[model samples]
Target: MWVRGVEWLAAAAADPRACTGDWDHGKGIALLEAGRLWDVLSVPDRLGLLTLDLLWRPGMSVPGPTLIDTAAGRVGFFLPPDPSAGWKGADLRYATKGAWVAVPPPYRPARFLEWLVPPDGTGTLHSPGALAGALRQADGALAVLAPLCGR
Candidate 1:
C-alpha cells in the first residue's frame, strides 16, 4: 500500500514510467520536469536552513515538502507552479518550465537527495509569496550575521 501511494505521488513527474522504471531498476532517483505540477525553489543550505527555522517558528505554520542536496550544499522547496514569479538571489536557483529536478521515492532513503520534509501525497505546495518573504528575511538575517561570524 505504501509503495502504491508513493507511486501515486510519483505521478507528478512528467514521465511517471521513467521515474518508476528507474526506481524499479534500483537507480533510486529520477529526473522530473518542473512547472507542470509544481516548481522548485533552491537556495544555499545555510540560507535554506535559516528560512526553514523562521517558517516553523513558534506561531508560524510548517512549510511544505523540502529536499536537501547535501553534496551540493543546497536545499530545494517544492512550491506551486509560478513561471513568472521572478525569484532572484545571489545563490538561488528556481526550476520553472523547461527545467528538471531529480527526485527520490517519497518513502525511500536517498544518498544525496534526502528530503528534509517529505511530501504527504496531498499535492500541497509552498506559497510563493510566503516563501519569498521568508527567504528575504532569512537572507537579511544572514547578511547581518555574516560580518559578526567573519564570513
Candidate 2:
C-alpha cells in the first residue's frame, strides 16, 4: 500500500503543473518532488496537519517558507522524531503574523534528551532545572523571525 502511494506521489511530482493550482495543496505535491521516499513516508496524517513548504520544487515563489497563509488562517508544520514515549501530536515552534502551527503524528513534543543534543557538542552545559542557580550568566538578545515579503 505504501509503495503504491509513493509511486503516486512520484507521478504527481513528475508534472506538478498538471496538478491543482491550490497553493497549500501544491506544497504537498511539491514535497513529493523534492523529498526522499523515506522522508515523504514519514509524513503522518492528522485532522489538520500542514507540512512546511520547504522544498525547492516547482511553482513556489518562495522555496522554503516557515509559514503560509491559508483560507482558514496562517499555519505552520514540523515533524519531530520519536518512536517511544511519544504520543506524537501537533506542535507550534514559532508562529509569526498570527500563524497557527500545525503538526501531524510521528512529530510531537521533543523529549528533554533530544533537546540536549546540540551541534558541535562543545558548548557550555546548563544543567536541567538550573534556571536561578547559575553562578554567572550572560544577557540575552531579542531575536525575531522576519518573514520574507512577496514570497
Candidate 3:
C-alpha cells in the first residue's frame, strides 16, 4: 500500500514546482514521505504559493516537560507555560504513544516551531510518533481505497 502511495508521490514530484493549493496539501505530504520516515514529520500550510511545514516530535518523558532540539534551540512540549494554565501554546499535552515529550516554553513558544526546510538548505526534525501518525494516516487511506481498487 505504501508502495502505491510512493508511486503517486513520485508522479507528483516529477512536475516542476508542485503547488499545495492545486492538490489540497498533498504536495507537502509527498515531500515528507520522500525523506526517511523517522526523520521528518510536518503539517503543511499554504500561504499563497509557499508552504509552511510545522514539524514536532517527542523528547524524554519526565515529570516536567521534555526538551526538543531545533535549529533555534531546545523547546519544550506538553508542559504548560504556567502551572495554573491547563494548556501550553500549541504543544500537544499528551502526544501519541511512544511520542517524545518536550518541556513547555514561557514566551513565543511556537517561535521554536521554526521552518522545517530553510529557503536554500535542507534538513528536517525527526519525531517518532509524528512519523507514525503520518504513516498510519497514509495506510488508513490506502485501506479505504483498496476496496475501491477491487483487490
Tell me each candidate's TM-score: 0.89, 0.19, 0.22
Q: Show where candidate 3 strays beyond 4 Å.
A: 1-122
- lDDT by residue (33-127, candidate 2, tens digit) is 32221111112112112222123226733211122323334333212211221223233222222232222111112211111111121222222
lDDT string for model 1 (34-113, tens) is 88888999999999999887777787666787889989999899998889988886988999989989877777756798
Stretches off by above 4 angstroms in model 1 are 1-5
For residue 8, what is the lDDT in candidate 3?
A: 31
Question: lDDT (0-100) at residue 110 of candidate 3?
Answer: 36
Lowest lDDT block of 10, candidate 3: 44-53
Count clashing residue pairs in model 2: 0
lDDT of 3 by residue, 42-79 (tens): 22222101211123225522121123335334332221
Backbone collisions counted per model: 0, 0, 10
* Candidate 2 C-alpha RMSD relative to the actual structure: 16.7
lDDT of each: 0.82, 0.23, 0.29
